[model samples]
Target: MIRTLLMIGLIGFLSLVFLHAPVRAEGEFGGLALGNGQLIFEAQCVGCHVHGGNIIRRGKTLKLKALQRNHRDSVEAIANLVRNGKMPMSAYKDSLTEQEILDVSAYVLNQAQQGWN
Candidate 1:
């Protein structure tokens, strides 16, 4: 009975630690962390740019080819567009901090590179 209780307690502790831990990626971009980017993207950008595709404009997507075609192939460009609103898209400058903007931009670029798979 004591062994059973101890095993249950150990399993419960491990479950809490693993389930609540933040997810992290393998690398960083421009000295910025990469993990929160996904969280921020999910929280803020997922509605409009689900899976890196644009809901409002089919021509403009977060996909690699479209981004390159639109000349928004770089992190700075993406960050700028996110910071300043384009037609049909809302600017996140007021709502998100600079670091968040960069993080989300990096996330978009990374997703684009990965084909959003």
Candidate 2:
């Protein structure tokens, strides 16, 4: 009975560890662990940039063409913009960490490339 209890405890512990583990994905988008980006975007940016479309400024949309035209085609450019707000847009430097800005920038670029579909 002791052996069975020990095995069950071990199994439960292993299950918890695996279930709580961060899931990392390998892919073209720098193999980033993706959940944080989407979650952050949803929580912070979705209101202004829903589906990559800019409600505040149509010309400043997050679409690939707009991003390219505005010289924000790269992740670094996007991250900088996010960190330091440009006029109408509010800065997120205080609210989000650098890593989080990078993640969301990557996500935005990826979504733009995919046409936000």
Candidate 3:
């Protein structure tokens, strides 16, 4: 029947909308590298930020309290810092791609939330 055919088409349309929908909002991060973030963090940042403590700047550690107080809680803020870099902290922008920065920043934030475990 024509009604059955229309229902089938409607179901197909809904399926496509749910499965192939593009991300359209900020703070989504659903498309960003999720697990690889940890790998990037371990490979590049462990030496300096082992256990989230800053070896060079002991006072400016990556601890959650410090990050919250300094307003570095969001991924954008952390990623910007990593990309730009401050004294004694080299810029990773040249070495790591934008995606790498995002992944590593996400890993850092997740680890900080988990007490660097």
Candidate 4:
């Protein structure tokens, strides 16, 4: 019947819209680094740096304000710290490869720069 066909068409349209809706990720780093940056953060940095706060509160916090003070908006500095690991900040060289370090660093830097919802 005409009603059945119209209902089916409406359902199909709504399904497509729902399924294809833009996926907004939780942090500022989403859609960057081909979308793998956040995954790297979850794997490497989540335990000691939950939401940019250090677990022991020893190192400088990683939010925008702290990063402005410590890193001074230098992505390279942040990257170097991630690679070399300042004293008391466990060196990730053994646990993560160079690329992994870069990815995770990019993720953190992005979040530190822009913040997240």
Clashes of each: 0, 0, 0, 0
**lDDT measured at residue 64 in model 3 versus the true structure, 0 to 100:** 90
Q: Which regions of candidate 3 deviate over 4 angstroms? A: 1-29
lDDT of 3 by residue, 1-117 (tens): 999999999999989655753332234565666566766777788888889998888877788998998889988999999999888888899999998898888777877887987
Which candidate comes out best when scored by lDDT?
A: 2
Residues 15-58, candidate 1: write the lDDT tens digits: 97567644455564665545678878888889989989888898
Ranking by TM-score: 2, 1, 3, 4
TM-score of 1: 0.76
TM-score versus the correct structure, for each prediction: 0.76, 0.77, 0.71, 0.63
**For residues 1-117, could you state the per-residue lDDT of candidate 4 as single tens digits?**
999999999999989755753333344443335135566676667788888888777558788788878853555566678777877777777777776666666677777766733
Task: State the C-alpha lDDT per candidate.
Answer: 0.85, 0.87, 0.80, 0.68
Error of 3 at 69 (Å): 1.9
**The 10-residue segment with the lowest total lDDT in model 3:** 21-30
Estimate the Cα RMSD of every predicted model relative to the unseen true structure: 6.0, 7.9, 12.3, 9.6
Off by over 4 Å in 4: 1-34
Candidate 3 vs. truth: CA RMSD?
A: 12.3
TM-score of 2: 0.77
